[model samples]
Target: MTNFKPGEVTTTHIHSDILNRNITLSVYLPEDYSDLYKSKVVFCFDGRDFLRFGQIHRVYERLRREKAVERVIIVGFHYESVEKRRIEFHPQGEKASQTVQAVAREIMPWIDQTFPTYKVGNARVLLGDSLAGSIALLTTLSYPRVMSQVGLLSPHYDHVVESLFQRCQFKDDLTIWHVIGKEEKDFKLPTSGERADFLTPNRTLNRLISATSATYFYEELDGGHNWKTWKKELPALLKYFLSNQ
Candidate 1:
């Protein structure tokens, strides 16, 4: 943490016409960021948690110092609250579709136009965990061309998700990295107090994505659904994203 050359971190609030709200974003540009060439842009949801609970920033800095993966830009989408996260990221949320569109139509374009990037979907990554992961998957499905690269960590599943996969078409150029905990078979919902089988649906989703022509990787580990479990997987996930491209 001390020896690595730290990246520049900046925060901003951008007004989105689609969501009709000021969306908060934080960007991490590696020490090697250059204007002469493009860099892969990783757009992460659950911005605040990934930095705090997930320790992605620390992990990323270490990765860069080790030269494990090539330098890339990381962007985090900050949610105001848990309810706000669900309203936009949940599969059944009213604004789910709009949130997906906003990432593809609004945020990505801004990132590309403002920075030296590939200016296409393949050069971008959508990464999130749980509900945030669910929206990442839906966003990729909704706009395959603009969001071809994705990382979904234990995506919270529902019939709506399964139905979307059943109805949508999968393109060949997509790359995906999805993971779930083997012990996450059943857990009590924090909000609804209902029993849910996260493992089964994640398996179903694996089969669904595996059946497509996507360049995909799926894993089931001996862990549960929490930041402790996810933080350890950050290196692998980021490597997977950088490896495929």
Candidate 2:
């Protein structure tokens, strides 16, 4: 077992001209990070929630200290409101594509210049939960040259499953770590009170991607669609993706 200690987290602002708002980012760097070394990075959506609920900094520190995973810088993108998250994280929302572009075009380049990053797409990860996971998938598909890997924790795949499958049929050198709870079969959407069955479509997506040439991992665990499950699985996912790199 690893002793989970908190890492150094700093706050910074990245200007997104497309959204016309300065998005706040919480950057977590390993204790040993320095200008002499370049590290991998994970860009996380729903930033504030992840920091508070996910306890990702502690997980990262434990993994890094134990050598269970490679050193990484986790960047948490903070959202102003639930409505704002819906617009930016939803697959078909008006600002959805623009949000992806902002991360790829604006945020990434800035991170590279500001920090000692690997500066390669394969060394970076796009991570998010629920609808944000949907956006992360879309962004990875759209900008594979910028972000080649994605961590989808209970992605809301109802609306985007078919289209994503169609895209996955083609050979894209992408790596994905996807997990959904068995109990997440039905849940009420936070934005709309409509009930959504996430499990079935997520299973469909797993099968589709498994058939494809891309590298993928799918886990259907016994839990619900909440941060508790995600937080519990975070260390394992980080170790899987960031380990021995």
Candidate 3:
């Protein structure tokens, strides 16, 4: 098959046995994608916002045009609704475990079948923001052999997630790019209207990751838990992870 365009996008839907629903994944091939390259694949949660609000395609295009770093294939998981997202992404939600199972059993296998994956345990990345980020954290910890890097953009951290981090074994190759806003110490969730202190919990998570042998980069950036900060920092996030710099 001839390469589509430098930044072409296509999509696929597959049924998730664990969630008992069909899920959509938007796939974006990088500027120079070819069989000769060992493709790094980034599986992002909260993908709608990552593409819309985060404008990752635009940023990724610029990175490629400028020849800033090595590029990766972007595969984004699109949630059906905000309510359903809560069910899947939240640590305490009804379908939380189901979401992880779906990714491990359904999504990851599908990715390997369809894409030119570099490696299962090294070049694969699992990432997201807020509650989505929390799911990334849980999934990575649960299946350390599946992914190497965890990209967390102001994730919603709680006691259960903290306990998991404290108890789980980290692969020596594990890397985390965690960015939490200092203002997230107290705030209301966008959809649920629930009050949460993300900063404090993320700080605790930072400490937990610090105790592990994993390569981790945790930072308290200037903005709160919103898309603005995430969008602005996304290029740096991509470069940091993709370039290993």
Candidate 4:
């Protein structure tokens, strides 16, 4: 139904030594892309799935045409596979943090060199869903100056809440936009009754963000955990992040 033009989608690849994996990166440049203006960049995890399931390209095209937001460079970082995604994206262990660091240190610099980006302070943003959300949040905390804004949509909250608040350093330089579906189900542990609930932990994280003088926006949408919900929320998220421009 949707006809997308050529040059609207650009693809690249990054090899990370930290994870010992090759990551395929997909970038969507706005129609007016030129060397004249440095576009804002938004790095998103679960790259392949976001394209196939979320139809993000169409959404971006419509929003940009309507002037709902400024021009942006959407960088989609693809993981190895769905099975390995949990281990890679969950911010629960040391390896997860290592992978996040690799992305920040290695992959991002490569992108900057390859593309015409606005490498200015607070111009870059990180976005993800579910476990990828945990990775994005942790990565932002780890490199607050580099990753200034984050869009967390329906994150899985288990070990991340305590780990993020207790271990990471928060500064006023960051702006986090957190959104969770109210109807999203909570995961149950085999031995322990139930792990940390999603909504409450996100609220607690919000409170922590508020106390740290960081710009924060928390929203609870009436929906469930799926791409459909995320697709519905993407426009508003784009507006909020691009409002300053």
Candidate 5:
């Protein structure tokens, strides 16, 4: 088991000409990031909490030092407020479309121009938790050429977006790593102020993905919808998908 500690997080601002908004980006790089080595780039949503509660930077550093995962850059986009988080992370929200466009058109191009990144789609990854997980999947499906791999930690599914599952057609190139807690069936949603059945929709999603030929992995743990469970599983997902490939 890895005992991970928090590492220093650096911040930068990028102006998205498409949305006419400037987004703050928090980044973590491996210790030897200055060397002439190309590294995979990971974009994470719901970032501040992930760094605070998930300890993802430390996990990354430890994994790299132990040679358990590949060298990589972790870029996090923090939600300004809870309301903004729900608004932007919602797959049907207008902000979600803008966020996806910013990722595909502006943010990725900036990373490619500024960092020593493996620019191929297969080398890029999108990661998110809960509703942000839904954002990650929607974004990857929207721009499969830019992000081919996704890590979804308990993605929220609503009745409005069932068509996405029926429309999924990226089995040929996209890969997915997903995990949901068995206890998420009666999870309370803050945004909707209603008890949601996350597990059922996630199971439906699992079945849908299984029907496709995409490389996929799914795990149902005896836990709840929280960071503790995700933190525990993060290292393995990183090693399996992003290491040595």
Candidate 6:
């Protein structure tokens, strides 16, 4: 097995004209990194939350050791604040278009320049959860040639279903992995009169995937919207994506 340490974590800031602010980005490099060779890259939204809550570095290390996935570089794009995060990551407003542009023009370019990455279609994967998942789906659809693989964990779908499908057409070249909890049907939120009736929307998304020429995988796990579920699902997700490599 390939033993790995925690690896290096670095932070940088980018000036975004679209959002009229600077965004901080966190990058996690695998322990077995080599600049001489290019590695597959996974771009994830909500960098700070993922780093703290998801423990992705630890998970990546374990998966690498097990040889389930190839060596990968993780790029986490952190939003400015909670308020800004919601506005930027949410796929329901005019600002959402700006946010996507910021990622494609500013964030992705910087990472491609800084790291030795495959810089191709399928080798680059986009990932997110909740609102970020919506953004990931939007971005991948908008830029299919750049991002061919999308990982969505428990996406939040209230009423954006039609717009999502209208904007992007699924092709055979794309690969998508979507998962939600079996108990997430009509799940309620504590703070407000909000709820995630994810079962129907997810099923709809799965049906769309089925109609498309894309390779798709859908699963219903035994948990709710939490890191435990995501962590448990990460290994198999990575294996599925990396198997094509």
In TM-score terms, candidate 5 sits at 0.92
> TM-scores across all candidates?
0.91, 0.92, 0.92, 0.87, 0.92, 0.90
Model 3: per-residue Cα lDDT over 121-207, one tens digit each: 767888899999999988888888887689999988888787777666755768899999988988887776988888988888888
Q: After superposition, how far is residue 238 of candidate 4 from its true place, in Å?
A: 0.3
lDDT of 3 at 86: 87
Mark the regions of model 2 whose C-alpha exceeds 4 Å error after superposition: 1-6, 159-161, 168-170, 190-193
Clashes of each: 0, 0, 0, 0, 0, 0
For candidate 1, the per-residue lDDT at 229 reads 86
Q: Write the per-residue lDDT of candidate 1 for residues 1-245, one digit (tens) a residue.
A: 11212275678777899998999988877877777777888889987778778867678778877877766788899987878888989999988988988988889887887778887777888898989999988888888877888898899888888787666665587888999988789877776788777899899888888888889999998888888788889999988877533
Clash pairs (backbone) in predicted model 6:
none
lDDT of candidate 6 vs native?
0.78
Native RMSD of candidate 5 (Å)? 4.4
Checking candidate 4 for backbone clashes, the offending pairs are none
> lDDT, candidate 5, residue 42?
81
Q: Which ranges of candidate 1 are over 4 A from the true structure?
A: 1-6, 190-194
Q: By the TM-score metric, which is better: model 4 or model 5? A: 5
TM-score of 6: 0.90
How high a TM-score does candidate 3 get?
0.92
| lDDT score, candidate 2, position 235 | 89
Candidate 3 stretches greater than 4 Å from native:
1-6
